[model samples]
Target: MSKTHEVVIVGAGFSGMAAAIKLKEAGIDDFVILERKDEVGGVWRDNTYPGVAVDVPSFTYSYAFEPNPSWSRTFAPGNELLDYAKHCSDKYDLRRHLRFHSDVRTARFDESEHLWVLELASGDRVSGRYLISAHGPLVTPQKPSIPGLDDFQGHVIYTMEWDHEHSLDGKRVAVIGTGASGLQVIPAIAPEVGTLTVFQRTPIWVLPKVNPPINRFASGLLAHVPGAAAAARLSTSAATEALLLSFIYNKQVPFAVKSIEQLCRAHLRSQVPDPEVRRKLTPTYGFGCKRPSFSNSYFPTFLRDNVELVTDGIERITPTGIRTVDGVEREIDTLVLATGFKVLDVPYDLHGVDGETLLELWARDRKQSYQGVTVHGFPNLFLSPGAFGLAGPSLFATFDLCHGHALRVIKESRRRGATRVEVSQVAQEHWMEKMRARVGHTIFNNPSCAGSNSYYVDEHGDSAVLRPTSTVNAWLAQHRFPFNAYRFEEPSAPAVSARRRATRAAR
Candidate 1:
């Protein structure tokens, strides 16, 4: 079928859904939300592992237009969160615009038409005037190269690609990596397993998740007063951003990083009676240096008699057991790898601007974008959570901010009668340098945490993925789509440029 939309969105997660809703609200229905999965909720729909929950509180994790007053928990689990995404999609009439199971294999920029040609998996080609890549970075799975892993006789499961049919009841389980996924998976599987051995590459600071139920009275008040939820979102976003700044912007900031680390250490020491276990679990790096985890139950779960924390690096994987660097062989019936996603890298083979793949273009430079939305050489293409994906305490804040930012830019482009707009290389380079400098000051890339392998930092040891600001700040700066920072072409020139791009695209 030959059809075109004014706006074409990839990935129906928070960003895509929010974009669709925003576009519809602005009376732009000639758009489509393309998703590879049969349903919406991109990552949330895919990752259904036990103990998988949002790191932030539920009150501010959702879209501003729709709030779930009835969230069962402060940090809603993966399933509930997915349900919330779907609920929002349905509520805002976004499902009608979603083309489920439509995987866009390649997006070619047609210079002549001043549009994007999306080649889908179903052998259908669609065009859109504006392309929004809400395709988040986390969907890509990264597996470790453990020798003999393929020969494992027992069931092996990767956290991202969780197997619903597989059960760990009464089985000896060996969990690998103590990252966010590790903390979540361990808590869920500890009780069910006959024995649970956790493999930790590096110790992580895990703060107690002070998650509590959203009170009924508060929900009612929010429903009536309205500003209550908005106020909570504002307050929470500020607090989260402040924490980030303390770690990076002001390492000397009083009680900034220490406060959280101290709390985590205390929790670990309190939970584990054995001094040896506590030592093994405690991180050597500054707490905020790594992606700090939040879970009150993770430590308590490890303290159980069945759980064992193994800090030794892995030597190799045997068919029936794992051999640690210390030559200790831990036999288990199942291997659960909590290895995190490719946060710094964009996995898809995406090529933009004369056949330069996204990875290759950003290889030496880490990722450089003006305000995390517009990149150099990619005209009319906007990415959600792009270079400065890290922003706001809540993903919802980032989602809304990005959607709002992109919409404002789109409107500004239309108002100026511009067909194509790309961020200036100078602006992008300056912005990228600033972010790299920020990461350099933060605890995440400090010397202590440098040796630790984490998806948090890039090859250049920069936290370009996260924005070190609040949603309000990001929106304030990006709300109007800085045309001054961009070089916009009149409609005629872009059409000619489009023809050239189309010729290159054909090649």
Candidate 2:
């Protein structure tokens, strides 16, 4: 039998690290962090494709408490982000709590023991009083269901698991999917590849990027100056929040949406000289239907003589190349799948009260939670980014808000000496209804977004990912949400006390 811990956190990325730090700060030290990979950085550690850099500014991307003063660029590269993760791990002593290469297969709640039991891929079991799922939605890569893809003879690479061993220099390459990953990798490999063909299912709104180097003097000021880092973070956060709000409240702020559309159109017109090429690159959907990307080079790469953009629908993959519905087969030496991740899908199995699985509950009803942190049936389980949980574009801010709410519950449980804590079904239902109404006003629900193919919309055709509320309101909700909404229960059985004694004795 595995010894039970106070808390068990999955994924050692920024979210897990933040949870661990908060737990320690709250004086709860008996916690374990389970990481599937050997390293700490989650997406930054995995995605090493060429031209992989953050779309958001570096200042806002980092943790508020621990800001890096030496970011070389406005938008830092993936490697630098990984280095920051390592630095944070060492600085916070998180390595001691981390269990590397521990892949969680399933998590089931043990009602009798009032504990969450995690079964790992290695057939190991871990028990914890509280479970925090820090693994993000983008962890699982989504492969395009193109027929005859396995029949391809050439090397196939996923953007998530990039193969640096095989050189792409002077090789004919074909990239599928025009999402964020596709946008970044296309420009990076275009200059090196012999001939590049980009297959686009849907066009993305591309805005001009303003990435400037932060020199030594500026870096020093940000580091040594008392208010410099705070000021920078504040300004960047404010700017991004304003932009995100305009999208969330498109019905209320029509002018902001129109302004953004005009700016994107002007940028596309300025970059691509050919009118026909520009038409193919432009998105018919309204701005913010899908997440917009920033790149000065993506549009210009199409102008290159070696690059070709194919807007035709993909029919199937042949032995040597991809065949479009237009009946053209573009032979290529390598196939790069820049297809995005399964954002709306849960990757692992999770069982809650009375053998009710999370998948079953979501399928029966819909993916929802009280605060995007806690669900009704899943007691003592907290999700960092739950359904309708993400508060803003900046993931760091969302982590702060979500984890802050989780910590409050954990602290309250400790104070009340409660062994089990779960949100009331009534409370969850009320929250879900409010969220549904709020999401209706966002641009995602607009008629223009019907063909956007955005991950924000779930299987039920609801925009269930984003919180659809302002960041300020999210923070207020975290602090001011009534604790009475949860039902806290103390240990009622002798077996539970005996189990705790056994766990302590084993430790």
Candidate 3:
């Protein structure tokens, strides 16, 4: 028999670390955090591209409990953020509880035993009373399906899995996809590359990324002054949450949209003076239709004589170059794929009760969950960025809120001595009915999203990513909502009997 733990957490990233720290705080330490990678930091650890940094501001990106006073800038770089992750792990002594390189092949709930049994890649089995899927949406990297990609002769690399050894100095480079990664990478490598060709599938809204360093005085004030950092975090959170009004509340973004467009236009006009090029770079979609990127240097990078921005669609990939639909074949020394990740859909397999997989359930009913955390058929299972709950202007805000709710449920179950806790189908239905009704009113459901090629909207053309609620409201709902919405399995007969005898003997 495999050793059973109180909880088994998959993915030792931020979410997993948060869960572990919260569990410890709750006096529950019999949990194991399994990470496939050799270290923590999830996407931060994986993505080490030329100009990797967070899109969100630094103050609000961090956890409220562990504020980093030494954030170098308002938006810290990827390495700095990764260091913060390591610091959190070290601070909390989470290393002792972590199992590195322990990749989970599959997880199944043992109905009769009331436990979650996970199979590792090394053919090892681990059982636990509860299971938490902390592997976030952007864990898996995706490459575009282009013909002759495998036959490409030169070096091919992904932004997530960056090839650090391969130098781009004076080398002709062809970059595919102009998403967030593309926007960041293009500017960083343009000055070094001999010739750079940027393939734009769709133009994304680019805002001014004026990242000013947090001065030493301010850093010291935030660190030394009581409640200063907290105040800054609150201010940033409020601002981020304010963007949600533009995202879901208003059918049109109103003044926010116009103001943002003006800023983008100014940025583009100032950087790329050529009218034709500016027109080619401008996005036709609404402000919040697709993920808006920010960068002061991105638009200006194209102004370089060696850089070429190609708007034509990819016809096919040749042995040495990419042939566009316009019959233009751009020869390349190396190919870099900035092609984003699989967000709306997770490729990993999960088996629940009666050998039913999550994919099968989603296939039958469409992918959804109660409060974007719990699934009906999956007992003792909690998911991050599940279904409709994935969205938040600040993902960390969402994570903090969700972690509190999940831990609350776990604590409630433990208090009741329950063997397992499962969300009822009726409860899930109630939440989804309300969520979908609210979805119709949001901008995500708009036709503009599909036109923008946003992954936020799923294959069904419905907004699958966002939770359609305010961040504060989400936090409140998690705290105020009734845990009775879930069904808790009763303790074993033997345990109950033993407890009764002990009580009688004490009397």
Candidate 4:
């Protein structure tokens, strides 16, 4: 007899871990979390670059269930964040239920049996009544095809895949792209490297990161005094909620937001003395168009004697240096491509139900889901922050909320004796069109800025990647799985034989 499980979660990231916790809380302990990596910590485990600190405040970035009473700092570093994930896994006893070092290659459902058969990287298969894909969209690194890229006789590394063993000391480094990763890496290794050259296509809006360490007094009050820690958590939550309110209802709260830009501009002016250099780095797009990065050190790094910020477009890579459009060759021993991930795009030719692949179905103009959970024809599947984007500063907090909400949907399906849950074509189309309409109204579609640093653009290069608006609103709206927005299908019938089950679907 084939071993069966209630659920199989792919990826042991924030979403998957949270899902396991929520499932356990709901008395559903028959699930197994399959992680590709040997250890836990999703993106946190992958990205170990220097000066890697989170932009979001520490208090609001944690799970509601397991709030940390002792946070070292406000803007937690990567080590702290990864430790928190490990701590969560331990506290929740999630490690025991995880199948580490296992990757899910493909998951196909037997509609009749109402079961998901998952194919693994090891050529083994597992079947489960439910399947959730928390693989996420951010980790996949996108390397742009530049001419003469591979032939360069130097260490070419993507920021996502950093070489911890390779020494950066005294090596001439060329850091490409100026996105979030770039912002983090530039300030960190700039002082250490021999000669650092930064190649930026579009300058992003930089904001000051108001990070602070938690004093012993504050920790004591939280640990000893009743409601002190609760009060702190409550205050942070209110502040985040206030910001979310402006985005959804007001859409133009100039005070709290513009003040940040003014602060950023002042910081930029102080760091970059040359007017032309400052002008080149300044963004003309609205503050929130691209992902607003918070850093106290990035601008200051540019001021370093060893760091050279180059504005010239990179034409190609030569034998020794990068050949810019200006025909200037900047010599470098190491190349770090911080070109960012393929956000608006996913892996190749992902086909869903009726043989309609996800890339083909949503290829034309939009990426839609029925309440950011399920898509039409793609039954027995769910994704974190899918149709509607997640709001708030912390992806961890957002994923925890999403996982809780998705757990409800799962329980609902089980309770109602659903063989497979699916979204109606009408619901999927309506949701997609409505979201696109909302996106059309935002500054994300700013007529002036499209090509520069936007992953929001679709395959057509329109800033269609994200709505180009409020992160808070996107987070709150996807808090729950709108059951009415989807359709549920009962299992066709339990198959007595494998041949019979295959025959039913192939027809």
Strongest candidate by lDDT: 2
Maximum-TM-score candidate: 2
TM-score, per-candidate, Cα-based: 0.92, 0.98, 0.95, 0.90
Residue ranges of candidate 2 with Cα displaced over 4 Å: 500-507
What C-alpha lDDT do the candidate models reach, one value each? Answer: 0.78, 0.91, 0.85, 0.73
Please give the RMSD of candidate 4 to the true structure: 3.8
Q: Put down candidate 2 lDDT per residue, 419-500, tens digits, no spaces.
A: 8999999999999999999888899978989789898887888788899999988999999999999999998878677968
Query: 1-507 in candidate 1: lDDT tens per residue?
Result: 457788999989887888888888877889988899899988898888888888877776787677667777767788888888878888888877888888888887777667888888888987888898888878887788888888888898988889979889999999998888888889898989899999888877887777778778867877778577778767766666777677665445646777777778888887878888778888877666668778878877767989888887899999899999889998889999988888745544556767786778778666777787778878888888788765776666777777777787777777888777777888788877777766666666566665566666777756677776545666677665456787776668656777689779979
Ranking by lDDT: 2, 3, 1, 4
Q: 276, model 3: CA deviation in Å?
A: 0.9
lDDT of 4 by residue, 305-402 (tens): 89888988889998788999999998899999998887634332334666666656666535677655666777777766564545454566557646
Per-residue CA lDDT of model 3 for 1-507, tens digit only, reads: 366899998888788898898899989999999899999999899999999999888888888899999999888999999999999999999999999988988888877678898888888898998988888888778878899999999999999999999999999999998989998999999999999999998898988876899989999999999999999888877767777667777565567766767888888888888898899899987777888878988888888999999998899999999999989898998999998887845445789786878878777777789888889889999887688875555777667766777898998998898888999989999998998888876877666565688887766666777888777667778788788899998867776687589779979
Give the TM-score comparing model 2 with the true structure, all chains together: 0.98
Clashes of 3: 0
**TM-score of candidate 4 versus the correct structure, residues matched by position:** 0.90
TM-score for candidate 1, please give it. 0.92
Flag the better candidate by lDDT, 1 or 3.
Answer: 3
